[model samples]
Target chain A: MTLSLPNLGLGIGWRAQLAHAILNRPDIGFVEILAEDYFLSETIPPPLQALHDRGVHIIPHGVGLNLGGAEPIDPARLAALGELAQRMQAPFVSEHIAFVRAAGLETGHLLPIPRTHAMLDILVKNIRQAEAALPVPLVLENIAILFDWPNAEMDEAAFLNAICERTDALLLLDLENIYANARNLGGDPVALLDRLPLERVAYVHVAGGYEADGVFHDTHAHPLHEEVVALVEALYARMAVPGVMLERDDRFPDDAELGTELDAIAAAIARGNIERHERGFAHPVLSDAS
Target chain B: MMSASREAISDTQADLVRALVHGTPVPAGFDEQRVQAVARSLVNKRRQALARIWPSLVKRVGDSFIAKFTEYGQTHPLPTSANALADGRAFLAWLAVKEPPTDDLRIEALAYDLRWRETPLGLCRRGGFGIKIARLAQSEKWLLGLRTPWRGDRWWGMPANV
Candidate 1:
């Protein structure tokens, strides 16, 4: 399957606390909303509607789909997500490759599934189910895991590739997660990037985190580390990244700080484009900018 | 290649979740330290979420809030409905049992109860008419909470002398 995704440009996660700040920024090309936030509301929130009115692409991102759970996908949640996408006129919706619940319990956190072939089969089935139910194309994201399951059939890259390959789901590669996993689990972030199907990456998520007790935590509450910014540079240097956005979940700073962080990301992307250009690689989307 | 069946994967995933939230033994072959770290992180995340939902409760509990909520989280997994307000109400209920609810805390709890009703699924907005009252902890003062279908909520705090 081929994906002709648009270049979303630089964006930020649409949060209520940051709504005013985000709207004030004229450079934002897109915004991602937590799908569940509007499940009960009859109409889109005014700020979001305003963003939509201004022609900013709003993407509905689901956090509770449990797409990798052993249980079957929740029909109601899938329908709600589809309805939300249709309401928002989203180009494509996104969900994690991890599960948030299993059995009769809810973890309230995204948990990793074993990367075995059997597990991969389950993921593919779930993704296929979601793809059939959603209004638009589905994009899956790799979560930051604290630990790997006991035995795994494939590495992260191969497992992610298989899921995308089987389901034709686009990728929302999160650079902070890659950095955290590499720091905690021992792997080369750039090497993993090389093995990944960058062409499938519909967008990218860049966030901040901190290390404690010798382990890096993807808290999304801190400032963007220089190392994560460098990963952004490395990724953009490799492909014509369609979209890249910042996700700040907690400890939000002032508007100036957020704008500064975005500028840094833009700078990194430009640097990557320069590198790609110098290497004689031509990308139609980034040609004029590079 | 050893292929895991759906049922097997289901059980394994259940076991892993149980360990993370219920403080069960770490699944074999997984790093115990890493599992513990994840478990801690989950607990902290839930606590932070609860604090956000119940700011008054957190402020009242002060430094003891973390320890109290952490204890409540060990045995009680998050509400299946995934409603932050429901989780906060559950925590408040548990807290009330351990310690007498202060007037402020009681008022806060009553305020939420006025607007939302706890259900098996989660917290749902009360649609019909309902009345709630609470006696002040330190005085003879009484608080009246009235919920209506259309007008939202109305509260009256009795005079201190009354």
Candidate 2:
């Protein structure tokens, strides 16, 4: 299966609080809406409608899919995504590979799944179920875990790649997650980046977090860190992914601050593009056609 | 050996969630300290998410919202079929049992009564509820300056069943 993953360039996660900033700004290549926000609504919110008319790509990103759960995918949830995709006319709808619910319990946040073969098989099947029911491609994002499963079968990259390979899913590699995991879980972010199939990365996420008592958490409310931007630069240098985005959920800074972060991201991406051109990296079209 | 069936994977994931939100023991093989850290962070995140949904409730709880929600979150789990507002309502319902029922929480639940309710599958909008009560609830929220009362043609024109 082939996906025409657009080169989304620099995008931001669409939030109502930031609606004015996003609509007024000219440089943002796309905006991602949390699919759950719009899925249950009967009609398009006026602000989102205005953004859609502005012509920038709007992707519906979901956190409630719980694709790794042992239970069956929720049909209403899948149906809602289909409705949203059709309304938004999105190229793809993305969700975390992590599960949010189990045994009729909703965690309300993404919980990491064990990296064993059994869990991988379950995730693959769940992803297929979501893929089959959704109107557009369902790209899966790698979630940040504070701890590693004791009885894991493979490294994070391998397990993520395995799921992508088995289900023919695209990747929403979150660089902040990689940085957080590398710092907390003990691994080299760049090396992990090098090991994964960059071809599968549909887009990347760069966000800010807080560090407390020598520990870093991807809170997404604070300002984007210099180290996180450096990680984005590192990823860009290696893969030249088709797109990258900024996600800020709380502690939203002023437009001046947001513009600075977005510019830093664009600059990093530009630097990587230059490196790719100098190294004679293939011109990215839809696929990794080198 | 534990079977690697889909059921096993599901159960383990459930166990992990239990550890994170419900105060269940950390499953073997995970870094106990780090998983506990993540679980704590998850509770904090819930506070943040619900704060946006019910700002007054958090403001009233002051320093205790995190502690209260952490205690409430253990068994309440989130509403599977509802959104933040409904989940906020559920949290208050849980709180009503744990702490004294504040007018703020009750009023908030009433506000949600104006919006939607829990269904077997998910939250569906209210039906058959009196528009007069919905209007009264809107006016009560106006006192908090929470939202503009449904006024002019907007509030009255909405179908009672819709």
Candidate 3:
């Protein structure tokens, strides 16, 4: 299926602390606002309004939808997200393929769901419900899991593919999450990327993490890891990525450090583009002998 | 394919959530070590979030912040409001029962107490009029806080000599 998503180019997760830095940078193509932050406000925050007026795409990213839960999607939360999307004039809103709350308890963190077919069925139902209610297209993101559930079922990529295929929803692929999962759980990050439905990816999230007690935590507070940036290069070499953004949630650094990280990502994309072109030039069908 | 009905999935999720947040036993078939790791990670995340919202509370609590907050979190699943301020308010209320509040803590708790009301649902912001008088623990000074729907919050502290 053709997603027809716009090429959002290089972007950064819109954080209040980094608002001044983001506004000063004219090269930033888009900014993703946490939907819940603006849900209670009657008017758009001035900085966000200025960004919108500047023609930077603002995507309402939600953290509370609990799409992977067995229970039906909460109508009120879904409505708030939709309203925020409409208010922001977002191109498409994004959410995780993980559950945040269950059994009247808020975990305050996205918890992984079992990858069983039954769970897949539940995710599809929830995604469709969200898609129906949202004013724009809905993109689902893969969350970083500390551990996988004990069950006999599909792997992460296959489960994501199934969800997107069934709902026609786009993917908000997070490379840092894939890296953290592979580092914590046993898997090859590059191989996992090969299996994902990259064509359905609407954007990409690259962030930083640290390993403690042999476990890599996807804490977006640190500097972007070189390995995660390499994943960005690897992803771009495979296919055309619509958008890629940096997600730094805490322990924010100054503008120069953020600029360096963004530069690294841009350089990776450039290197990947060069490799892609060279590979195309050397294709057997386009050989000089022909 | 292992087929789990919706009810089964719901029950399993509840069990996992309980294990992670409520200090319940790890569910069968799951690795105990990893579950513990995740539980710790969740607590750390919550601690960071709460610290962000209530820096003074965490700072005043000092070295014991993590221990206190972790203890508080195990019993009280995060409030449904999902607002850090509400969670912090709830934590302050819990702390008041466990230990005597410092003057700073008392004043912080008073600000929130005067500005919002705790209901069965969650913390609701005061819209009309409210007044709270708190005596500081260390200084033995009285603090008066007033909240008006239109005028916003105002606080007056007794003179240092008092």
Candidate 4:
């Protein structure tokens, strides 16, 4: 079962570098705000408020909630995310299937979790905990894996299905990640795309990356290659996803350079046959500012 | 039964992250070459991230920055918290001390700390302290973002900024 969210047509990952740019751009429909990037506050940040005023949807995308860890989810972190979602008036929120930390140790980057039945149990338990705390639906995103676990009982598709089935959570399918993993690990990205649950996807993420030593790290700071763009087109043909956005982290380019990528993403959607340019939000939903 | 499986997950997860960031051995049945490649790439990511927070350090350290930064990471666990900017700050403070006590190093630390503030968001410019710190420090022949910190300290065992 999928909870319906606002289809903020073509959006960009909320970034400070492009903050002013987003305000003036009409084609931009939504912004996926990095949940951890903001300071913990009871009130909305100025930039997001500015976008909200202009009729743009903001989704709180989190990176640190390690849901796949063997331990129970942190109540405080879950609370923080709930507050962030309420503050943004976002329809849904997202965290990774990967773990950011293990027990007491922190990797400071998304680390791969073993794909096992035991792993699925912990994920379902933590996901349910988060779903209970948050006022909105929590969508779990699949991360780019650099390495694999020895004891994998299933492939990425089956494992993802297991978690979504058990918890009834939505998926934020990142096409760039699918392409990257396939390119690095040797598989057909298209085949992986064909098998996954597209109906559960609330939105899609198309980002660029830097390649070194024949491995493409989903850096998002670089430009999307032609092959990955084709994968986006393929995903569009197969599934009519509601939203697709561009994500960039650092080494931010000039306005024109970034805008071109956003445009490319929008065009990719058309080629994929997702032609609905309409937005779901009728009026701006405002929470108490003070 | 559940508890035993949980322990297995916990131990393996820890071992994997340790292998990636700490240069430990890869777990069995995993591709060793791919795991090693990932470890190096992760270290590179760490270096690039640190470079953004501590740009002058990267510039100052020149070619040896990667080796020095890798050495540092081997000893210190980079915090996985969202406050990577703050953790980067702590690393800079640590870098300042280990930097052989030079004028440029001191100036970098002093100027960096004075000019930036850890706010609710991230490291932001301290209000009213932007170019003034750089200007004042520059007037003392300590070039901000221009000169390397460890260039001339070896001759005197210390060349104070003043």
Each prediction's DockQ against the real complex:
0.61, 0.50, 0.50, 0.37
Residue range A76-156, candidate 1, lDDT tens digits? 889888998999999899999898887688888888899999898888999999999988999999999888887888999
User: lDDT by residue for model 4 over B23-140, one digit each (tens)?
Assistant: 7888777788887877776656777877765677677667877787777766666654536556555666677678553555556565556545664334544543123223233234
lDDT value, candidate 4, whole model: 0.73
Provide the overall lDDT of each model, using Cα atoms, as 2-decimal numbers.
0.86, 0.76, 0.84, 0.73
lDDT of 1 by residue, B4-47 (tens): 58888888888888898888898888889999989888878988
TM-score of 2: 0.87
> Where does candidate 2 clash, by residue pair?
A150-B29
- Number of the top-ranking candidate, with TM-score as the measure: 1
Cα deviation at A118, candidate 2, in Å, is 2.0
Pick by TM-score: 2 or 4, better one: 2
In angstroms, how far off is B132's CA in candidate 4? 18
Off by over 4 Å in 3: A281-290, B1-4, B114-130, B135-142, B158-162
Scored on chain A only, each candidate's TM-score is 0.96, 0.94, 0.95, 0.91
Q: Which residue ranges in model 4 land beyond 4 Å of their true spot? A: A274-290, B53-64, B80-82, B100-162
Model 1 chain A: worst 10 consecutive residues (lDDT sum): A281-290
Report the poorest 10 consecutive residues by lDDT, candidate 3 chain B.
B116-125
CA displacement after TM-score superposition, residue A8 of candidate 4 (Å) = 1.8
Clash list (residue pairs), candidate 1: none
Q: Please give each candidate's TM-score.
A: 0.93, 0.87, 0.91, 0.81
Order by lDDT, highest first: 1, 3, 2, 4
Error of 3 at B7 (Å): 1.7
